[model samples]
Target: MTPASLVRRSETWNFDIDAYTNPYTPPSPLHRFPPWLSRFLGYRKEQKEDVGNVLGAVWSCVGTVLGLAVIAAVFNNTASIRAHNPPALIASFGASAVLEYNAIRSPLGQPRNALLGHTISAIVGVAITKLFQLSPHFESVKWVAGAVSCGTASALMLLTGTVHPPGGASAVLAATSPEIMAMGWYFVGLVVWGTTLMLGVGLGVNNVQRRFPLYWWTPVDLRELQRRRRRDGRADVENDVQPEKIVDVVREGEEKVSLGGIRIEAWGVEVPEDLVLSKEEAMLLEVLRERLRKRGDDGVLERVPSSRPSTDCTMVLSRSGRSGSDTEVLYSVT
Candidate 1:
């Protein structure tokens, strides 16, 4: 059976196959070799680090290297690469690189985020570093200043909902070099050419490997997500809710207090023990319930089927109960 299938099928039973049949231990930090033992009898042992199936890890690492290496080699000594270039041009290639790598390994790193995120951050990092270079105060401490600049860039990336780790490295590399730093506002091109080349390398190497998944993804939309939100309908599918909406809700101060640590208040209702809705879902449902829960609201305790339930037959109180309002409310599935 395939690794994924093996995991899925194994879940139906509870024998702890990982421990009995194929136990794995991560590499230890200590490599012991006593003075007497080191004289002639040296024992070498290999530890397992990549735990989510061996084949997958190797293929992923190989792809990652190819992706990073290609850009590094090309952009490191090129005049065409620089900062402050057009975003669309940068994204066109950068996004492709990331998407191609993810296509061979994971499917989530799509063209949109991958393109905009990496290029932008890399450029921003280079910009921040360049800003510090313009001042005579930071000239003597360029390395430290550049590192700090990258940190700030990383923070900006987090705030912007785009955190690409390699982008930081790319930025620091360009900013510290006198040649790249001199490129001034035009340094964005370096990131584009470098990142795109790396992704190209990853695509070429990964396509030849079998341990990785084929460059095939079952593209999913919101309707598909809603359909799969049921147990029987999407038993094998995994779901990931976008976290940006949650951040927006928090920024807007929607959930005032933690009702049983829920950070939202309501009446005539007990919060589920483990209501793990995404930030967007929580904020939306909270708002919807409050607006519908006016004092004269009827059927305050009505059963409404979930518009987006999980792949299980359990009911989620998608909307909260209001006090004495007039309204009829809305599940298990096959």
Candidate 2:
């Protein structure tokens, strides 16, 4: 073929093999330090900080105190209520509810998680203990019954879209407590009261913290499974590339597959084994981490993984939402 024909053919079959080059590499050190402009203006770019968290905690306690006071007023005829003593109720039950709220939302305060989790769990605990008391047929198997009840309660809570960590305590509390046993199924009243009090406090406190109420019912992430179809003509090749076939090829001999898992065994990294941040931003992560652990401060890096990141953040699509946004923080969403 003539040189002109060769040139035309090469142009006709154009390809860019390296299609996924990321313009952004490891983040810059300067980004860790906020530009003077941001500090001066106090621009709130993210919701993560001590501000909302601290205030949310304080208000939850305040709400708990107020709830106990309301109860004391209603039951004024009782001997304990006669002396106008709200101390025991407020200090024990009310205080625990607040701590329980903290337990539900602390570290990562996913809103919808706390409400139903505690409510359902508290009821389960009461049920388990009550079931043990009435187990005439299984008199010697109360312990096993209680455990199975707890496990069943746990599965129910997880299945029903509420997985509050503290609620497990609530369930166990009702199941194991002598006082709870005295109350019997009447402990359902306690469950209702505690749940109502928590919901009220969470709503009020979260509002002051500027958290949207919809967050309580909305999921932070959604999972989607995709199916791909092959071209009509390629039966054999299509079979090889089917979903299960692809999985077999990739996972047949591999037991573990994570960035850190590969790094230690393949690349010989020496840092504490779990920091598997991507190659691009790993340095910045280590720097901020060391600053916090050794120097006792978050320092330059404000926050990391404080919220659930959207998986879309990792892809290099036509218009990345944060393409030109502030560079100080980088998110890991893979």
Candidate 3:
């Protein structure tokens, strides 16, 4: 294979962490539940549109109320927490409820973000505030401590890919609120408890009508992607595939060139000529194409019933000579 072809092949089939980390619809486990139970669970491969409708609005309100109420009840009624002068219920969770209930589809609303964001921010906030306390003039510069904690938490959240907006408030509260400061490291436990309770309620309530979390850890199934990559790698090594074979695969169908070397042909679907796609969108499409190609190679496509209507689509990625000229073709045989 030409150096360019080898690079293109590696890019196509190689396992990259970021590729599998991006959000995508994963297969739902709720299908295994009894039909009636599954209906109530509301797990789906596709998310329902979050349009403004009376039923959706009512469900959102219900989820918000239930989540907050559950947390409040636990914190307030618990004898140990009640003994403390100030209640353990933190204000930042009110903002979290907005995302978890109202903006259910948002990445910020997902479990990973909601839990880690609050916990990490709480830790940062408490640690910074404690350090400030050592200065003896903590009262004079407590606001500065709050600002520093919030800023540090923001950076940490971004780096961890768990950027929930409410997390910043949690950090600020930990530094500025006397009750939270008095709790010190114990505040971390309270944040965790509140966040866990909220997520628990979200799972039961939000899933009744619409999906609360689009994904738990990641939207893409990383385990399956890794398995496929390993299998493909083994096959490539065993076959000692030649460059000519790779070229032939790219040239299998009739060739048509397009701008940016992206050739998309669809039979039933209408694609706009002036369509502009972001890099992330292009990468996602590439991942979908890879999945289709893998299914075809495994004879999965051949097993489909022929009586059903289907469409033939092809996508070709070609690079110019200056950019290591090469072509990779993907076909969806349905």
Candidate 4:
């Protein structure tokens, strides 16, 4: 059977309302660093492409050295911080430098994860260690305290959507290391300070050739999503149409297809049946589709004369709520 014949809309498929809603929209003043420093920051939309792996590796090393050095210099030189018996530089930050510099693209390396993950883990670790210290044999069961703190921090990080791997080490260090435990709640402040310094260095180093963060708060444009929802809601009210009824209509119009056992929906992506994609690949396609949709909504994609032959299968995209006369050819399949 032909590919078209294999395609059908799945009525049972449900829309993810949460995907379009972002709690971080109009993010707090603390999270407004990117916009405030827009000139210095680099986002995915601003970059045409990434650097080569060799260049990327070089920058990674530079970032790691600079980030760690800055933190160490500040910690070691400061009279108050240096007074601590074992020094103030947390060991876990070494792991964090790898993520922040080498694996800059990872979600764990993002500002939210880097800041909140380490902070939250530090808090949990300190609290748990204090409780264990109340026991007379606290020294004997210190390893147990370390294990418990790490596991608890991991769970809390996952729940809060801030899963930084180094955070686990921070928690363990707080519970097991005598020096870190002596720092008490002060350990939390050091974690935050070190993370902040590393991120600052990353911003400068990574943006020299590549984007440091794909996004500040989230990958989705929360503000745009909110505007779309409001516009849709107003239209529904004027038409006296229930939201459920509108969803039903949309579902009826959507097409679903399966290619080599992989399900595809009306998200504007198409793949050959023989082709297979990893989860990351599929997510990347979806992000690109979202960007295109946003650009289309802004009426930035207008029709232009095509130099290619007419035999090409061209896909046209028009501004939302506009007619075919305003459509523009987005891509052509040869």
Candidate 5:
């Protein structure tokens, strides 16, 4: 005679066991830490700030201000421009300006994308608005028309290799704004002109320190460059100013050359009698040992203490007997 509880337990339905107990299930972060604490901490892996960071931000601000000012001046001073076009100072220009000046290296920030994307999106938006004019009975058709126009413009941007995200806003503006929609081709001219102004400003500002619009139309292939470097045996990895790897290898009996905080301890090789290495392991060990010997022989290896103050400095050795005792050679990373 089975009890009611036992019978009910046995009768319980079994769902997909694999789904609940999946071996490939990714670990959840919820269990690791409290969401509130994590949120408070924010990003853990932030990049270290450099000298150019503040200057770059200032430069970006200046470019945006100048670009917007030019557009505003054009629209405010010229009545004919305002009659046919939406206000030159639109919301999209802010996003465009950021990419143009700050993230000038991105493909979307290129002059071709900025100009073509806005122009095409404007045309698409106007076309969609005109299509909606035919079906005036549908009260909510305008919203749908705007969304569709933006979507189509995005697709067109991708197809044409001019995917400027801000251009979608331009499309939305064209479809939603009655004033701009009424003007037809004149609206496109406004977008082009505004974008052109920003592009010119971006070129001038970015070129001051960094190369903007690395190419006129073609997107720079960073991956291709990396691949070429790899193929070339790391020959041209460094440009005009190559980064120095301050290795501090400790020799058996040598004067320590200190260079600020940068350090790399000497790698010692010791094969124990009980130790066993495979063919590959033995070969690697041999190569490593040879490298160690070569580096040791060079006498360039020295320990740099972590407590040392600055990153850049000059060490002058006043040789008493040497004729050119005061001859100072500068070794700057930049």
Candidate 6:
């Protein structure tokens, strides 16, 4: 009765007899295919490398190389004292370099985060190891200490607004790695030194590319803010004059617009006293003049004597008849 009942229950559970006897399955035909061909044909979840990342890749490599070289040089040159171990470079520093160099635009990649997060994590890790007296022989003790250290490091970094993801790895290294554990609190100092070196490289390399640390502690640009405010103020005053009608003149590498005697200027483009507009810009100006002419009861486009003898593109346009009166408006579009 027991055997019969067991058999019935096993059948009810749908246990596979084949799985128990022979679980192994023959490899698929695809296994015989060339790897390159498979890669070309197979569906992949990962996206192709962005062409834009070429510059980033080059800079990251340079920064990583430079930063690590400096650290290695220091490590080699420094004399160690008896009974005290100088900080050896840790694996986490490699990860830190990736963020600091490769992903410099990230908040966690900033100098403050890289330095503080690693230092805090290393300290926490060392503290946990010492507090627990975690022995390598006892796997459970090591695991507990490592886990606690990692958790504390993460919490501290997050609270301090210095959440560098690699700091967790640093905690794990400090708590679990034999080399780091033996070095004791010396690991913290090492982390600081390494971080500083890497950060210096990152700053230099990233700035050279005209991008990096995208923000300091804050993303606010005070200069940009002030400029915006001033622009807004100017716009408010010109609001009655139809700010949209003010044509933005692009001349070579300058941006300037003159409307109602208010000159709006921006970087990378300047309007010279005698600027020659591009074909597209000239067409746009004509379109604007046409629109104004359509609105006017009487309008005529006439060339006038230029104050600058070299400038022949000066054109004067007069539109009359809002109230049956004539008004002369001087607009120079080159």
Number of the top TM-score candidate: 4
Task: Give a tens-digit lDDT track for model 4, residues 47-145.
Answer: 476788999999999999999999999998887777765454678999999998888888989998899999999999999999999999999998999
In each prediction, how many residue pairs overlap at the backbone (N, C-alpha, C within less than 3 A)?
Answer: 28, 0, 0, 0, 1, 6
- For each candidate, what is the lDDT? 0.45, 0.44, 0.69, 0.71, 0.62, 0.63
User: Which residue pairs collide, candidate 2?
Assistant: none
1-334: candidate 3 lDDT, tens digit per residue: 8999998888766434445444243445766888666644445655557556687788889988998899989988888776664554689999999998888888998998999999999999999999999998999999999999999999888877788999999999988998888878888988898999999888888776676677776666655876777788865654453222211122223222233534321111112324434334444444444445566666554322222122222222333324554434222221
Is candidate 2 or 3 superior in lDDT?
A: 3
TM-score of each: 0.38, 0.39, 0.61, 0.62, 0.50, 0.48
Candidate achieving higher lDDT, 1 or 5: 5
What 10-residue stretch in candidate 1 is worst by lDDT?
A: 246-255
Quote the lDDT for 219 in model 3: 61
**Model 5 Cα lDDT, one tens digit per residue, 270-330:** 3322333333343343344445446767875654343332222222212233586754322
Report how far off residue 307 is in candidate 5 (Å). Answer: 82
lDDT of 1: 0.45
lDDT per residue, candidate 2, 173-261, as tens digits?
Answer: 56555555556555555555545555565455444443323333433211111111123233344333322110111111112213442
Ranking by TM-score: 4, 3, 5, 6, 2, 1
The top-ranked prediction according to lDDT is 4
